[model samples]
Target: MSEGPLDDLDRRIVHSLQQNARKTSASEIAEQAGVSASTVRNRIQNLEAAGILTGYRPEVNYEAASYQLQTLIVCTAPVPEREVLAKKALEVPGVVAVREIMTGTENVHVEAIGSDGDDLSRIGRDLDEIGLEVVDEDLIRNEYECAFHGFDVKDV
Candidate 1:
């Protein structure tokens, strides 16, 4: 990791990975970024070491996987206990993700997947027991993502 900000090469590598990490190869990214494959590999390693490249995750289709219900459980926790409660929520069965928002009310947003309504109800009860007030629950239909445009390389 360099002490300075990411250079053009670093930005290009990150942008390429963000678009598709599973299908893209180091050689392919190297060609697009006008660098050698080894350089691309080295850069990726450095990025990971610096914590700039944290993780690569697969996009899952819960419905296709037989998890018929995808839910967003919005909750409110005491401001001082928000972070702790958010972490505890993740331990509950069916809980897939938990986000702690920096707000007074509705500060914890939890994403959960369940086979049916009963499963969701159980998860909600578990969250409540952990001190989170279940404010709302909505069915999640879809999600979309894109690479950050700031990482796009400018034509020189």
Candidate 2:
């Protein structure tokens, strides 16, 4: 994934924004990058238009919502059914994130957040019903104690 003609200044701007998307202003970014605020804004818009900046999402403290249970699930499936399986996994309640990995066995990994043990169990059973072979489940003990953040998955 080649980037545009992004100099060190551009990289710094991007990195700073990635750290704190909402709090960091264009003026602040420009000051940090030693550029004008308008320049920073223009560069950001360009990056977004080029699909380099996908989205801006707010970071949340899931513990406040009682999002206690967290688990990492590995899903295995035939190559041809990869997309279908992934779609089904998305429909599974409490599943937070899913990724198609490079490993030959499991085609996708699902991160599920739930309220309790029963909620996690329900998600697991739902995944199984859709023919997603569950290879592993690593439960996270303290979800509220965890700092939760989202990512802007740039096209890379």
Candidate 3:
């Protein structure tokens, strides 16, 4: 991704923040990014105001939270009704994340979590209940812990 007005120092601060947002301090961020602490603080605040920095959150253990599964459900629906389908998909429980991906096969990628196998199964069932034309579905059993990493949690 292209860095808009973010200089080298700003980029460094962003990278460090992305690695661990909650624990990163302005002074520490400045040291890592090679800038003044105030600069780091101001930049972060500015980014937040611009909707670039969303919020700081800890990486919670899903298993500890009773969430034990992750599945990437690749789905296809009518192109004209894509917005409607996306809206309906959001209502399904256990669906933590959803994206309208541009791919050769599917138009949507749903990243969801469930309490167990049966919970994930219900996610698929719920989608069907809402009338989404699921051409195919792929469920990956999250055996170990998992983390979400994307630009949504960071800016370039």
**Candidate 1 C-alpha lDDT tens digits along 1-156:** 222478888988888899999998999988887789999999999999999999999999999999999999999999989999999998999999999999669999999999999999999999999999999999999988999987877563
List the lowest-lDDT window of 10 residues for candidate 2: 146-155
Q: Model 3, residue 7: displacement in angstroms?
A: 1.6
Listed in order, each prediction's TM-score against the native is: 0.93, 0.81, 0.76
Candidate 2's residue-wise lDDT over 1-156, tens digit each? 224566555566667677778889999978765689999999888878877678888765566778876789888988888777887799887887788776698888998988888988889899999989888889765543221222222322
Better of 1 and 2 by TM-score: 1
lDDT of 3 by residue, 43-62 (tens): 88887887867877766567
The regions of model 2 sitting more than 4 angstroms off are: 1-5, 141-156
- Higher-TM-score candidate among 1 and 3? 1
Candidate 1, residue 8: how far the Cα is off, in Å: 1.4
Report how far residue 84 has shifted in candidate 2, in Å: 3.2
Per-residue lDDT, model 3, residue 149, is: 39
Query: Order of all candidates by lDDT, from best down to worst?
Result: 1, 2, 3
Root-mean-square deviation of every model: 2.3, 5.6, 4.7
Best by TM-score: 1
